[model samples]
Target chain A: MSDLSVDLGFLKLKNPILAASGTFGYGLEFEPFLDLNRLGGFVVKGLYYGPREGNPPPRLVETPSGLINAIGLQGIGVEAFIAKVLPKLQALDTAVIVNVCGASEEEYVRVVEALDAEEGIAACEINISCPNVNKDGACPAFSPESTRAVVREVKRASRRPVIVKLSPNVTNIVEIALAAQEAGADAIALVNTFLAMAIDVETRRPKLGNVLGGLSGPAIKPIALRMVYQVASRVKVPVIGMGGIWSGADVLEFMIAGARAVQVGTANLVDPDACLRILGEVEDFCRRKGIERLEDIIATVKT
Target chain B: MFKDPEARIVGKESWGDYFLLTFDSPAVSALARPGQFLMIKVSDEPYPLLRRPLGIHSRKDKTLGVFFKVAGIGTALLARKTPGETLDLLGPLGKGFNIDPCLAGKPVLAVGGGRGIAPLYFLAWELRALGASIKILYGGRTQADLPLADKLRAEGFDFACSTDDGTVGRRGLVTELMEDEIKAGGGSPPALVCACGPDPMLQAVALIARDKRLPAELSLESRMGCGFGACWGCVQRIRRDGKAEWIKICEDGPVFPAESVVWEKESP
Candidate 1:
């Protein structure tokens, strides 16, 4: 049998499959259907300083194969999450990676500082590329300077490992990845949702209430894979790949392409038990291939 | 919520390319309401990664029936199954129609078009038992498209029928038939108009209710992920203030008041 354990400097995962933020909804939501402890880890939904009701109506639109959403980062905020959501999540056996988002660099630091004080939070993933929020014209993680500054500040404020989630809507993702690595980011999660929009042609109006939305699913798989390959080759920190991963074969493809760990996002939207199914398939694939450890597959590109 | 470990396919019937599947899931039956639906994984394969959403037609004992059209690979697989087979199901989800107040000795008109009639049948049955005066208005492109006409007639419902081809009853849209009913009933209108159909049809009925000043409610359909509030996949636009607010149709409603929906010339 193949061993699926992996190490990312400060944190360790039993396997390479981790639930992406937003899709998993703080781990508690999936507890009824999924065994949270069996998988590697889960990244909770993005948190802000204050409670937010999020954007207005028509927040989501279904495309031919995927979905576009403009949810506006609606959440109960850091204080409530710590008080209510955190305690329940902490009880789970899985490693917890809280995803933090903010309108300004200072807000990011403040949220990180609050989370650092909480117990059972294994790490924090800095989301600098959420397309839903309007306070920031574009996510700060899109630019190298802003990405570095946010990473440096958060790393300075917390002792926990900070994983900077990079946006795919950029001129060169490697530049942003390298910048995060240089500024003391413990790891990097590549390819947040691509900026997109849909139209109700008959009405000549935008389908989503926000007019613009973030696209995720099988439609963006090729782009996400290419970006992961690009960033993994350029950055020294471990890379967590995401976007359109539906099965174990897709996970292996991401591992071969270069991601040390892969997160399942849109697939969870389609199948609530997708993460568990994918994890089982990965173990079966490893056993069938006679692989001894999951680390042997990371960044193992074939000519 | 307990998982239905046994993927038991309790029953199956064919309606053209569509299939009416009944599964033995005590968990789903125990929780399901009249208009809620289930997300069924037709195949364990990854090609069709998402489960197809199907409305719960009826629930009895420990079994829940789902009515679906074979529009894709998932439905096609479901149609091929026998009564003894098992299919994976996750369900009894989404907010159903509110039948309590409407059933208080009030005259209720249940309107449906095409496959949309599935959920309304259960609602009508529940209303009848509650002693509400129930009238069913069914519309289809042709007589053949009316999948449950015989079942409705057998149920002894006071019904009106219309078809686009003039094959069965009136030769216009179901709305034309509804107009006559509204005229005869005078300005008071029926106690409520409960409708479920295509988006265009629902939009038309909503407009009629607004013009006639009739109390109306509708069951809306959208592609969903979690079938619960978590994924935010099945969101619909509703006017809260002067602006629009996104609400999860699966949770807040598959049912909404007619006045709240902002219907466009096209769906946006």
Candidate 2:
């Protein structure tokens, strides 16, 4: 059998499929359907310094091939996650990547420091692109200097490898990817959801309660694949590509476009077992192609 | 809850812009109760990102039926689905209506307006079998808007109807008819009042019921993401200990005591 194992610098995955942050709702929610240990790893929901109630109603809106959500990073916060959620998550066999979101760089450092001391956290996925909240005049992930600063601060504060998540709603993703890498990020996950909005024409009002939301789904695959290809080629750190990934075919497209791993987001909303199904399909495709190692396909750009 | 091993579009029927699609999900049927809903993924596309929250119309052996009005692109696509097609479906989720056993033999009234009648059908059907006197009061914009009147009549239910255009049994809102019935029945409230419909109508009914100190239950509708409680998208404002509290409709209830709801305020 070909090796599906991938060395993401400090982290190792038995397979290249990991559940995207927020979509999986921690690993335990899916326990009733499948064995968590059988998958590569799971990313927990976005974490803040304190518990967050998140945005108002209509936080999610549906698009033609994807969904836009302004969830405003609703979560139990880092302390609660570590105290209540982490113990249960740590018991699982798969790697646990905590997704951290903060209003400012200092808050991000505080969250990273707490998770860094935790026993089971394999890595930290720095979320700098969340469009749900309004905080600083600028988001650290949006600017090269700010992205580098946050990455450097977290890397300095935490012992675990930091995977900076980049926003897709940027002019050039390669610059941000390179900036995070230059700031000592061990790896990077791109792209976070895109900024989007929907209006109820009859009511003449926005569909989502938050008015603006982050768009993710099959509609974003092509753009995400392109971004992954560009960033993967530009950055030296491993890149985790995600946007509307639904099937094994999509996984292959992302890998071949230059992603070390792919994260499945909105598909989980469609089918709770989507992650497992994608994993099975990937393995089946590998077996059918007589391909031994899944890593061989990463960055296989067609000339 | 048993896992819904498969999701196949077993039945599809269209009525104007509305479509009724039946999915074969034994897990949902086995665990489904009245007033609960399922999170349906209408298309694999991302335009309509979140799953559509659909009320369970009926559940037979291994299949669950959902009735949807084509309000948006998702429902429009759902309306065009053919049988033998497959769509992804998540649950028989959220808390449904509560049937008080103590009021089993007592008279009960069910109020529905437009598509609100969807859940009431199951409630009336189940109550009738339990030997309860079920009186159904339904209303709509016009005669054609009432989809299941014939079925309810055929079920031998003592039901009254109303339409805004005066083309039906009575002119004006269904709440007006409910008030008339309560007056004719000696001013004492029915054993219980269960209602589901437009918020304005429900608010009116809730006001009258609360004034009379009548025990009433209402089924609320909200746009939802994950039908499971994990999303917390479907929340309603309720009064707890004299303070307003946010209750998850997906978990706490699609059903709530009439007084528990903050009728004039938007959901939190």
- Using lDDT as the measure, the top candidate is 1
- Kindly list the per-residue Cα lDDT of model 1 for residues B85-133, writing each as its tens digit: 8877777776787778646687888888888887888788778888989
Please list, in the order the candidates appear, how each scores on TM-score for chain B only.
0.92, 0.92
| Residue B50's lDDT in candidate 2 | 68
Q: Per-residue lDDT of A117-167 in model 1, one digit per residue for the tens? A: 889988999999898886433888778999889999988998889998989
Kindly list the per-residue Cα lDDT of model 2 for residues A229-255, writing each as its tens digit. Answer: 999988888999899898899999999
DockQ of each model against the real complex?
Answer: 0.31, 0.44
- Could you tell me the lDDT of residue A207 within candidate 1? 91
| iRMS, all models | 3.2, 2.8
